[model samples]
Target chain A: MPKLINKNTVITNPWTVMKASTGPEILQVVPGKNFIVPLQFWKLYQEELNEYDGNIAVWLDSDENPEQISDELHSLPLIALNFPVFSDGRSYTNARELRQKYAFKGEIRAIGDVLRDQLYYMAQCGFDTFEIRHDQEAELCLQAFNDFETGYQSTVAEPVPLFRRR
Target chain B: MYRYDGYDHQMLADRVAQFRDQTNRYIDGKLSEIEFLPLRLQNGLYVQRLAPMLRIAVPYGMLSSTQLRKLAYIANHYDKGYAHFTTRQNIQYNWPALVDVPDLLADLAEVEMHAIQTSGNCIRNTTTDQFAGAAPDELEDSRAYCEIIRQWSSFHPEFAYLPRKFKIAVCGTVDDQAATQVHDIGIYIVKGDNDEIGFRILVGGGLGRTPVIGKEIFDFVEKKHLLTALEAILRVYNREGRRDNKYKARIKILVKETGVEEFKNKVTKEWALIKDSSLTLTDEEIDRCQKFFDAPNYQELSNTPTQLTDKLQSNILFAAWHSQNVKPHKVTGYSIVTVCFKETGVAPGDVTDRQLEQIADLSDEYSFGEIRISHKQNIVMADVRQDQLFELWKALESGAMASNNLGLLTDLICCPGGDFCALANAKSIPIAEAIQRKFDDHEELTNIGEMNLNISGCMNACGHHHVGNIGILGVDKKGEEYYQVSLGGSSKNNASLGKIIGPSFAQEEIPDVVETIVGVYKEKRIGEEKFIDTYNRIGIDPFKEKVYAKAD
Candidate 1:
């Protein structure tokens, strides 16, 4: 069980990450299974949203248009996007637009190469949780989020602008 | 130089303490290596091939004698007794223990200096002309704006984690000595027709794997809205810059993709919102900042000193040095003395601790305790009196700083390559040294006349290889070093990136290639035309023919 620290409180992480029974939960999507939802999964099961609900996560390619997905799918429990590398900050924009413009309010998480340095930034972009790799220390990644004492600009979490601050 | 007020001092002190705590936590196993990486990088600590390298910001290359002495002390005490002056006018210590870095930060804070934003993907030290305040034909002193930007960008919350490192440079004079064109944001402080000071803002310029000359965003950005306009530009970049691919993340790439007009519009829209805010510069604040850089009390004397004439007539060496290492200062009696770092048989920009101390002494004795590091990897004492020129030259000569190759072939801007830097693909110092060795004779160098050869280890182009009249770039082929040559580049007012001649050549053949290029220049030149003018006239065909003829 991982202890999750939100913006102001520490609580038990409710989402059960899937993995091989023998390996770390961070390594697998779900127990003994890789729950990958294809583009067609959203289209084919548009009306059966509650039927397929479980401890599963969704992934999207950069080429995939978010507008094509049904509005109902936005209420999913977990969604993780891949960051190819440190230099590719396109996903950051996508993440921000998805949360701010599209209003995808569910648990939007980052999956790949989500290094510790990017935790604070990812959080600012409205990622409530991060599905960091098994090799990475989750506890350390969490600490990186709180590393800076002050931020000069407002984001989704803190709407009061930097200039307005006393 | 921007003096640190109470707020600035407190921020720097807090930053140092924060870094110290982060370092302790990492060592105590509370923070992982991955987690601690950005924290350390933000503090200007980079783990290099040999040891951790810490780059200390000498804002706009201006330093007091006290600051230089502190740097000398740090260089001697903590690491090697040598520091390399970077193209951005920052000083990089090659070998500092990671554990002692916090202490180094503490030491730096004592001198009102810190390594903050020197590394990581943030706005770096805002560079300006080394002769910002003193240069003739100046519209406004650029250091005042540089200081304001420094304060505004210091640990800026929104921009701390930029998609890529951002660099800004301001040039006040007509001459683009700061290489403003290649920065992320290049601001030219110019007076409008109405005699109001404003900036001609250029955005998305940078030198790296992909070299780009910035495009003009604003023809006349008013003095009041400078900060707000800059904020708007940054906001647009923060919101829209490419993060998926590292190579394509620079604002240049954004400008290229979005087109300058569209990018300008986006910035304008963002600016419209923030322009009337607190970030807008007021006349009072601007005037206050400008007061500090008010011109020194210059005494007028004859340009030609009787003693100088005697020295020049008697000593040819002194004459050559004077011709090359000294520039015409705005004041009649004073001259800007360029202390060349490009000495033969020595790595360019590497100044020993002893040399730094001597420089500090010279600055105090001759130039009102102020020294400047030029973009050309040299130091400048901007206010050297005509009468004290001989004494200054004599002292510099004793310290091995009086290299009579200020703008000559030997005055190469060479980067630390495989010998020290981990990012380098091939060694650059050896190539620079080889060329220096070939052109060692003072008379021969003077005859070649006013050449600028810039060498970079890799495509990252830290040496400003793109804008050199003669550029040498080191490339790797099958684990072996090869050098590529380019010509006709210039970073002055008419700035342009170099054009590569052709294929890469073996390391040993670079000197001959350079000679052939010079040979072509000499043969085609009309009445003491420079290498750039010669290259421009004859084009690269003749040089290419001579350089590659022996290859096949």
Candidate 2:
């Protein structure tokens, strides 16, 4: 199981990422279990998920745009942004859009290909939780937050640019 | 020069510490090579053919004397006793041990320099005209905006992992010295209707396997909205740029495929949402950045001092160098002096550690302790006093830094090709040397004045071959190396990509091919018209016909 950092603290992960549906089939959700389903799955089965879930969240692939589910953002507890590869950073934009453009107040979690070196930047892009890759040590990744105390640009963490703040 | 305040210094130190940890992790088998590739590359470390090449970012080609000394120290201690200045106005160490890069970066941090975003798929250095603040035709200083872009792009969270590397250039003068039109995004500082300054943004311009002249996306973007506009474009690109093929991944490909109008519409839509956000620049912040680039103290001296006039009359060599290498500065008494790195037999842009130190000292003594690197891979002492021209020339001559080939055919821009780069198809420095040797005659070179002959080892166009008036691209023909020559490209305000002259040539035939092209230019010349102007008037057919006719 991948250890998770939630709100800058290491915590036991309760969410299970469900297998993505390939076709038009809607995935059935098991009751009383926290689950993170694919965006397509949530779009197809949100009505069913509303009645039978302990906690249901949607995960977006790197190519998926947050605006696709912008109307439903207020209802979701968390939105997991996937990094198919560590360097494919489209999800970073998705996270920024979810937090900034749509003004989504839910927890924005970073999942898949997440690692220690990327945590500070991921956080700056508005990700509050990280489902770090299982091969890495999560406890050690905590120090990544303290890697840079400040950034130059107007990031999600700092709304104003450094020059303005100065 | 932009001094690093406490925040800037702390951020650099933090970045150094983080990179040190990343390096240690990579060495300890905790981070795989695949995982560490982008991490190391974004930090400007490239494992080349011989060893790791570390590129140090000279922000907008502006370097302080302190930074120059530190670069010299790094080159001497960590790598070979010399470094290469790239066409992007960055300095690259051709040989540095992988283990020592972190230490070198730390040393750089002490001088407020770093290798951050010098390479990799993110936004690289934001360059500007080497004569930005000093050029006579200047509208406004573009370096301040370049500094703003530098700070914004540094470790940008969302854009750091772009599909391909991006370059932005800011041009403040009428003459596009920074080669703005060939960059990923070109920002030309233009005056508005009310005489207020704004930006003219061009997108999708780049040189690589497929070179494209950037199209104007926004005719005018207001001053405060510059960063917001940039963010909108970058965000759109980040979400939409192609990732399937590395060659097709640059924003140029996307802009070309999407059509500039449609791309502009998307950016406009995105900008509407974020234009008034906290990213908007305040007048105070803009003024703060502008203050750093304010003109140095100057004594009101004559534009052409009697000593300079006497030297020009008495010394032929100094006259030649002054004619070719010096430009009019905005200030009456000052002149911009280009220190030529294209001395014959030496690799273009390669400077010895001693020369780097010497240039540093010269910058201090002659140019107010500031040095600027032109994108043409030469150094510039941008504020030299007219009265001290002769003395400065003597100092430069003593150190062999006074090569009188500033825009001449022999002063070609050549990349560290197959000799050092892992991506090069063939060697470029040898071909450049061969051409330089053939055109060693000063009178003949002067006759074929203001030529841009650029050579690239591959289609990556690091040497900017695509925009050269005479471009040589080294192509891998099966197992053998062949050179393809292109004609009529210019990186000026009216920039265009070069057209291939004909079929490729053998390595030995490059010098002859270039000479034949020049011979045609001389024959077809109409009363001292420049090479590019002549080529444009007569087209490539005449030169192509002659070169192939000789072969036949």
Which candidate number maximizes TM-score? 2
DockQ for candidate 1, C-alpha atoms: 0.13
TM-score of chain B of 1: 0.98
CAPRI-style quality class for the chain A–B interface of candidate 1: incorrect
Evaluated with lDDT, which candidate comes out highest? 2
Model 2 lDDT tens row, B182-229: 888999999999998999999999999889989999989999999999
Give all candidates' CA lDDT scores: 0.80, 0.91
lDDT of candidate 1 vs native? 0.80
TM-score of each: 0.84, 0.98
What CAPRI-style quality would you assign to candidate 2? high
Model 1, B1-552: lDDT tens digits are 567666567667777877887899789987678668778888889999989899998888999999999999999998789999998999999998989999999998999999998998889999989887777778778999998787668766557667899999999998889999999999999888789889999998888889988999999999888888887888678767887788998999999999999999989987886677656676777786788787777887988888888988988878888998888888888888989998777889999999999999999999999999988889999998988889899998898788888888988898888889999989999999899887778887788898889999998998888889999998999999998889988888778889999999899999888888888888888998888888888888888888888676
True contacts kept of each: 0.07, 0.82
